[model samples]
Target: MLQKVPKQYLAQTRNIFHCNCKIKIPIEFSEELLERAFEVLEEIDLKYNSYVSGSYFSCINENRGNWTPIDQDCVEMIRMIKKVSLITKGHYDITCMPLLQLWGFYKENNHSLPKKDELATALEKVNFRSIAIEGLNVKIGAEQEIITGSFIKAFAVDKTIAFLKSHGVADAIINAGGSTISSLNDASHTAWKINIPDALSKDVFKTGLQINSQTFSLSGSIDNNLLIDGKKYGHILDCITGYPAENLQTGVLTKSAFLGDVLSTALFTVPATIRDEVIAELKQHFDFDYFIIDNDHKKIVTECFQYLR
Candidate 1:
């Protein structure tokens, strides 16, 4: 039973999935301040929207071979996504558009196991490495299309926070569809308390996953709708297999929600033999922290989180 709290405001402006958006700011702010925040969400709905076939990114996908030009914001986002993909060792990729179309997740159609030959062909056309950005110019292989399903949610949080900060609202929390970004501690330094939901159950978060001014993103299969023949199928797909990852689910918390989103998606696809190496690489590149739910449903926290319990 997921209940809405006072700070929650949901609108169906985006795609069909309920965007459980929440925001909380100090009481000192005026009505105009809150209105500005709402406007930011609506503005994002018009641009960067996945449902609209004519969006900037969508048009790039349609004209796959053309030198599709992109705005600075979109370019910056793609650049950051690429950097994170490198750190994740290709576990998460945004260039799986062909495979996504075959699976029919976007159109709410029945899920079927794609033919081996067909999926292989789709995979051939789907490689993030093929898409390159040069300043504001975007280039992709003639057969490939770009899809930002993995990064868009977290990016939205980033953009929303920027909008809020620009309006002089220094203290706030924005949670959109389970992805969150925030500057806790009110304008006067009072802390904000947030509940981190238990992965096993939605009853309540056992303890808080705190942040003063940072981004946090969680990706897991425990809460997905891939029910086929009484078995569940998750939304996170393995770019390697062109199939949903099985057995393990992962959650990553980082200074940037965009990176967390990629790591969670990528780590889920890493084969058991190389998971340790991937973790080691993450440690080397960025100050990242993670919690992995193993095949046996055991929770293993990274070295940075030993005191959470």
Candidate 2:
């Protein structure tokens, strides 16, 4: 006989994307299926993780001036990233690795401020428009580099959610390092409850939000930051300024986890005065809402932003 209550399966691992990833399915599922889902995540990590030696992404960075052959999936992902970059007016760029490295973000215990000349040189190679894609071949300008830290993990989660849905699984939530979360809930489970943390305060949750079959991505200046001489420097850098963005936090909700991840990072760098204009322009191409906390702790949210008390 079928069990009256559904069994929940929760799995977690810290190997993929160098972060703690968790997936919860509140329905009876085979262990093999669960393992396959994690395998999917690992497969993505192996193929495109730039940190991995000889990976596709690393190869592209290695041969910056030469065209490299890429698969269809790579082409699509790059195209999507370019589209968002165009819409955001270069506020979010995958080619900002030069600036990231200049600020010592990619290193441990070696964070240092860059000199004026160093910052200028890094900014010269930070243009996303320089990434050229032709057919199955892609190339970047010389001295240019691409970093997938912003959206690659979320992209993997979206792929896993699609896989789960294909196998008749309905109620599931995948959390990638507490930064990106993608969910699939059926009528049986209407939504997943998520807590929103206060950006200025530690150990404080401001509110709880409910998400249904959507992705929630949060980018904050407080997390994964470096302190140099008592000044906090966040990992999210502004491509134009060649410095860390000043926004405290930005949150985005979208149907695609990839989009959510990219948008959240982009929004964090956008200035508050013109943020509404950027959001309006984005709405024309995508369906999403956002909330941002500025440096002054002022809350800015779109009219369509939904929150549950």
**Which residue pairs clash in candidate 1?**
91-266, 92-266, 226-233
Per-residue lDDT tens digits for candidate 1, residues 1-309, read 987655432222233114666666666677566666656766655566555577678777777887777789788878776776666566667887787777666666565667899889988886777778887878888987777666666666666677777767667777766644454344565445556666666565676666767666666666664666676667777777888766455667776766777677777766666778878877787777877766676666876556553
lDDT of 2 at 288: 85
**Residue pairs with backbone atoms closer than 3 Å in model 2 (clashes):** none
Query: For every model in order, what is the number of clashing pairs?
Result: 3, 0
Total residue pair clashes for candidate 1: 3
Candidate 2, lDDT over the whole model = 0.85
Considering summed lDDT, which 10 consecutive residues are worst modelled in model 2?
A: 300-309
Candidate 1, residue 255: how far the Cα is off, in Å? 2.5
Estimate every model's Cα lDDT from 0 to 1. 0.67, 0.85
The TM-score, computed over Cα atoms with residue i paired to residue i, of candidate 1 is 0.84
> Model 1, 69: alpha-carbon shift in Å?
1.1
